[model samples]
Target: MTRPSNMREWSARARAAGEAQAEPTGATLIRGARVLDPASATDRKLDVLIENEHIAAVGEALAAPARASIIDAHGLWLMPGLVDLCARLREPGATHKASFASEMPAAFAGGITQVLIPPDTQPALDTPAMLIRVQRLARQAGTLDVRMLGALTRELSGAALAELSALKSAGAVGVSNAAAPINDSRIARRALEYAKGLELPVHVFAQDAGLAGNGCAHEGPVATRLGLSAVPVAAEVAALRFWISLVEDTGARVHFCRLSTARGAELIEAALGRGLPVSADVAAHQLHLCDTDVDGFNAQCHVQPPLRTRDDRDALRAAVASGVIGAICSDHQPHEADAKINPFPLTEPGISALETLLPLTLQLVHDGLLSPLQAAERLSRGPAAIAGLDSGRIASGALADLVLVDAEARWTLRPERMLSAGRNTPFAGRTLRGRVRATWRAGRAVFRASG
Candidate 1:
């Protein structure tokens, strides 16, 4: 087989390889591994056989043919690769901070086989042509499976709706304004109504600019004691209420992104209880950190919808456990070193997330907030469902997106070893228990940790 120079060609070769009638390809047997599939409620010691780009079989003590390659997994956990609902690649225009080529490896290393990139770049992906360009770039980069979210409004200005139908046809899994808020309720209603007509899901980050003002930290004692501007929790609650009401009126499939407040989750739960077609997600950082993390002006702790109080953090975790919040997103915003050079309030609000997503989530499992199977559901199955993708599962004939994790492995996060161009992670030097040993995308190994 000839090596492909670009991602498009690489995909062609892979497809052709899968289609070969008489190629007699060798199967890969992952033996003695604990197979965990949250989608099917499966948890048992089993062997997985992968042939080409699909799973061949999954059962106990599976037979391996002479032409098969065997990997001993005596104590490892094999599960579906995580599906990230929100991540910032910073490509096309913000390569100084991150690009698909850089962030993809980091994502794979963290056991994320698929990610949905938001349209928040310098030149937003509002047009079909722009979406095509990004898809082409991702294919050429050939790191992992990446799908772009088309901008809900043109250039994400939230002024007028973009061509949602065209963008969806161009391979946008969904439409979103990302962190950009639509101030005009009329425009927001129109966008949702249009999206409902097209049967496309709209993902939004709810924030009331008027209520948030210039604040960077959550309005609480921490902010008061630290002498930083406060963004009241009311900002999130009010925005969520407005969006949910719009969903009820328009019957649109809406997804709330990066929800940070306790009251915010309560609002979402109430909407869900009312049978409104709405789903929501909380960033992994928000599940662990709180306003106190920014007490000493720590810029890394500063993030959009800034970390709320401990009560909020606990509520978010409980929401995840109770199935109110279905997905966990990295909200992986990567920024250059200089972006966080200023004081806490002046610095950019984000955390370098891809590399730390998995371990941090495992921390939840250790704390009894979520079980291993529940963690897998929130990390993989839930996100996949939200994105309308047929991934994040391990089954017969399913796409072989899998990850091998050592749940007891102890490791420390170091900025020097990160693959993302942005090194502004708050988890630096934090010791984590779980670690990714290997990640496979479509039956092909994409990442392997160092021995």
Candidate 2:
């Protein structure tokens, strides 16, 4: 089904044109900026020219066209816009928590231009009609490029396999049962085989439901001290081991989502050693914050597959640094405030991430855990590769999806100032370095830092 182009009411074409007029004109030259092109493996000072939503040139001193805007990017780092592999922009069902309209702006504010939303929603994106509906809603929102993931099982129930071919035909980039794991290995193997035949990547949330068993926090000293039921590392490890065995048996491409345990990383590392076509992502929160953050009965830190020990967090950071982890996603699950107002265990799991992904990632750089180029790779190139999207690069003929950041700028997290409807972030009031100064998607400036 063709989406209605007129439904996009939030376009910034007119406003962007006005802003363009106020700036110097000449092929939108981004001057004196350090360019980081992970795809091209070029990290140096260069001027990039954008024309008609495509990168025209990149060099030390590129000439701009007579009628184009010139942006001064001195002391700024210019790189490809981030491609978030996992994010939940609740539109069809839970708009009160988040919508494409709200999430897109938040994504832009954090330097993201493309996002792959999971299938966990009201009607669920398991059918062609539902996938088309998501596409239409994304078009109407019109801020960032959105791709949908088809649910791996019907209604994400893990009982029956979804129509993989039909969902892919309807524009699902991949298939997943987000936030819910397939408890039965037989069922999981069947789903993997079906996805293998379709040559579609299957995204698995590696957690054994039986092991997780109504747990609300990570199983550790923190959970014990807080008097909360815990989700053990075995839940994640056992599921990963089963999935890895299935991958070897079926030759299916698998992408693990939000790997939170040290054992999870070890399993992935061993799989890579054996040459399996598998990749995994670590959420920014999991990489930085740990289960200890859940102290004092603060439900905001609650998460699915729950946060783990400091050692686990360190292991994830090391995995990213060692190249075992391919991508770093926001896993941007937004929940309404009231949903989180209850006591610890009953509160919803997830935290608002679209707005904080970039700043939090920059914190990794500040701590010397990740180089600037590695951070760019995890945030952009890697995620783009996982979704088969033609983005996350700065090259001739590449789409003009770019972000310019002031690496030294500092700011504090403010939930009320966020664009996402959900105000359930744990980063609230935390000061951080680095800031997204401007974001351009398809030659359009979707966001600019406030003065």
Candidate 3:
């Protein structure tokens, strides 16, 4: 999947705008890199020219413009910065674990420029003011574009619906209950119907509360042998069935978040076959780990929708490769050391995953399960499309959100070197390939890894 950059030649208007600035306003020339832009199905050695906040031009041997800063990206890979849809930033609530200030850098370091801030903050994103505050905090982190998801239920209590319209006006990209279940069918139906009318997509974490009651690990041989409370795959199946039924009945666009089971993928595929306006994403970790990884009560492997069997992991990978699952996210929930230091069941469930996203995604490529373009699609175009965001492209006139990767570089995930405050990653000490060497947002250098 390689295409010659057919971008128009750089113009005088762009050069004039660049020269008008008192500062250098120099264009950035990234040369000799293998550009993998899935939006255009492009994968080849090329040069990219960035001016102001957009890509000026992209092609082989693109000429260096006046006052341009050249980044010799020989032997590296370049692609659109990932748009992560489920990065739960612990801000305006649990700063002790990780704040927007901390996670934003980790996001950038992982080649993520745009991230969806889930609605489960301390005060929740029920109020426009709370959403505004979270957005503000994220913006202050420099070049990280954060889209806020308004609370689907007031304070995510699953009782009263939040001011979805107000939150929309206040810049919410979507609405979600954020892991909270609306036990009442009438209220849930009304919420979906109302949100559909408002043209807002609903992000749902499908899990039957009762079925998953007190479950800390997936119902499998691993959990049984470990004597852990088991969360059966039925929990996810029942919950997804519930949401898909609503999507079909209400004609509401719904996104299934962090899908964990093979049965869940089958259901999502069937719903899509029926032409329901539905989408799905899996956390990067789920595509790699399974319940077996939880052996020895490794608290770091603990996560909601607890890791399932290897068959389930394989099914998920197949879904992504076949486009049945269109997106993959970090599902980042950074917790303090003490939060995960307790016994497996007592510890908070989540992985400090912002920094592992790119490497793990690239691992799928290395495994030959996906081509480079397919990998880029899952990381960028696919997620951006789900969020209805104007991102995840590397063509002319596209926002200059991009990452330069040392695709051949192998590195160990050392907790001390991580940017996120939470040192609770299961990938810690694991050697991963495809390191993010540098990242840019809106054409400005934001993160450059020290070799």
For each candidate, the alpha-carbon lDDT, in order, equals 0.86, 0.85, 0.87
TM-score of 2: 0.94
Write model 1 residue lDDT over 368-423, tens digit each, in one string.
88888888999999999999999878899999899999988998888877766678
Error of 1 at 75 (Å): 1.3
Model 3 lDDT tens row, 1-451: 1211221111122122222321323499999999999888899999999998889999988899887899999999999999999887777777656666666667878889999988988888999999888778766544578898999999899889888999999999999998887898888999999999999999999999999999999997898899999999999999999989988899999999999999999999999999999999999999999998999999999999899999999999999999999999999988777898888899999998989999998999999999888989999999999998988888999989999998778999998777666678999889999999888888877777775
Candidate 1 at 360: error in angstroms?
Answer: 0.9
Q: Give the TM-score of each candidate.
A: 0.94, 0.94, 0.93
Q: Whose lDDT is higher: candidate 1's or candidate 2's?
A: 1
As a whole number from 0 to 100, the lDDT of residue 300 in candidate 1 is 93
lDDT by residue for model 2 (1-451), tens: 1211221322243223224422222258899899988898888999999887788998987877886788899899998999999889877887656667656767888899999999988998889999888898787656578988999999998899999999999999999998776767788899999999998999988988889999999887888888899899999998899899999999999999889989999999999999999999998989878887899888899888798999999999999988899899998988766888899988988988988888888888899998899889999999999888878899988988999999999888877776666678999999989999988888777778878
Task: Give the CA lDDT, 0 to 100, for residue 163 in model 2.
Answer: 94
Lowest-lDDT window of 10 residues in candidate 3?
A: 1-10
